[model samples]
Target chain A: AQTVTQSQPEMSVQEAETVTLSCTYDTSESDYYLFWYKQPPSRQMILVIRQEAYKQQNATENRFSVNFQKAAKSFSLKISDSQLGDAAMYFCAYRSAFRGGSEKLVFGKGTKLTVNP
Target chain B: EAGVAQSPRYKIIEKRQSVAFWCNPISGHATLYWYQQILGQGPKLLIQFQNNGVVDDSQLPKDRFSAERLKGVDSTLKIQPAKLEDSAVYLCASSLRAPSNTGELFFGEGSRLTVL
Candidate 1:
C-alpha cells in the first residue's frame, strides 16, 4: 500500500510571495504519478499540478510547480506570486502507473494554506 | 465540456438514518469516482466505476455503504443507518480511462453530509 504524507499542517504566505508545501510518499512501484490538488471553501477539488515519477524534470503550470525528487520519495508543490485565491487546503496524491485501468489515488492529509494581503 | 454534477448540495440526518447521494459524470468519460472528504482532510476514494461496472471498491464500508453506476453515466452512493463518522463531504469526479492519461479530473461541488 502507498501512503502520502504532508508534514505541514498549516502555512501562510503574503500576497505576491512564494510558498512551498512539502509532501512525501512510500511506494515500492517504480512507475507512478504524483499530483497536487486544491480544495477551496466551495468544496471543489481542483488539480494544481502533476509530476510523473519517471520524469526527471519537474512539472509547472502557471504559478504552480512541483519539486519532484524520486530518489527521496518527495514531491513538493510551490506556488509563486501567490494570490488570495490560492488560499485553500492542498493535498498530495499518488497513483500507480502499472494499474492503468484500475488506478485509484491515495491522498495524504492536507495542508491548509492562507494567503495574507 | 460540462463538468461532473452532484445533487443534494447539503444533507443532514441523524445517526441510524439512511442517506443517498447522486452523481452524473461528464459526457464520454468512462471512469467515475466517489470520494469522502472529512473536514481538514484529503479526499478518500470510496468507490470507482467503469462503464456501469464496479472497478474498485475496496475501501467502501460494504456493511453500511453501497454505490452503483447504472448505464455507465450516472452514479448513486447510499449509506444505511449512518453513523456520526459518516459525516463528510462526498465528492464525485470523472476522467478519461487509462491510468497513464493525466487528464484533469472534473469534480462536482460535493454533497455535504452531516450526521447528528
Candidate 2:
C-alpha cells in the first residue's frame, strides 16, 4: 500500500513571495509517480505539478515546481511569485506505475495555503 | 478539449436515503475515476473504470456503494442507505489510458453530498 503524508496543516505566504509545501510517502514500488494538486474553495481539484520517480531532475510548471527526492521518499512543492489565486488546499498524491488495469491516485491530507496581500 | 463533467453540484440527503452522482469523462479518454473528498482531507479513490470495465474498486464500500460506466463514456456512482460518514465531495476524473502512458488527469467540479 502507498501512503502520502503532508505534515503541514496550514501555511501562509505573502503575495509575491515563495512558499514550499512538504510531502512524504511510503511505497515499496520502485516505479511510481508523484503529483501535487490544488483545490480552491470552489472544490475543483486542479493539477499543479507532477514528478516521475525515475527522473533525477525536478519538475517545473510556471510558478509551480517539485523537489522530488526518491531516496528520502520526499516530494515537496514550491510555489514562486505566489499570488492570491494560489490560496488553496494543496494535496500530495501517489500512484503506482505497475497498476494492472485500474490506476487510481492515492492522496495525502491537504495543506491549506493562505496568501496574504 | 472539454474537461470532465459532473452533475448535482450539491445534494443534501438524510441518512439511509439513496443518492447518485454522474460524471462525463473527456472525449477519447478510456479511464474514469470516482473519489471522495472529506472536509480538510485529500480525495480518496472510490472506484475506477477502464472502458466500461471495472478496474479497481477495492476501497469501495460494496455493501452500500455501487458505480457503473456504461459505454465507457459516462459514469454514475450511487450510495444506498447513505451514512453520515459518506458526506463528502465526490470528484470525477478522466485520463488517456494507463498511468504510465497518461500522467495527467482532468477533474470535474465535484458533487458535494451532505448526509444528515
| i-RMS for every candidate | 1.8, 1.5
> Candidate 2: deviation at residue B107, Å?
0.8
Candidate 2: clashing pairs of residues:
none
Let me know the DockQ for model 2: 0.76
Writing each residue's lDDT as its tens digit, candidate 2 over A59-97 gives 999999888999999999999999999999999999888
Which candidate number maximizes DockQ?
2
Residue A54 in candidate 1 has what lDDT? Answer: 87
- Model 2 chain B: worst 10 consecutive residues (lDDT sum): B96-105
Worst 10 residues of 1 chain B by lDDT: B98-107
Deviation from native of the Cα of residue B76 in model 2, angstroms: 0.9
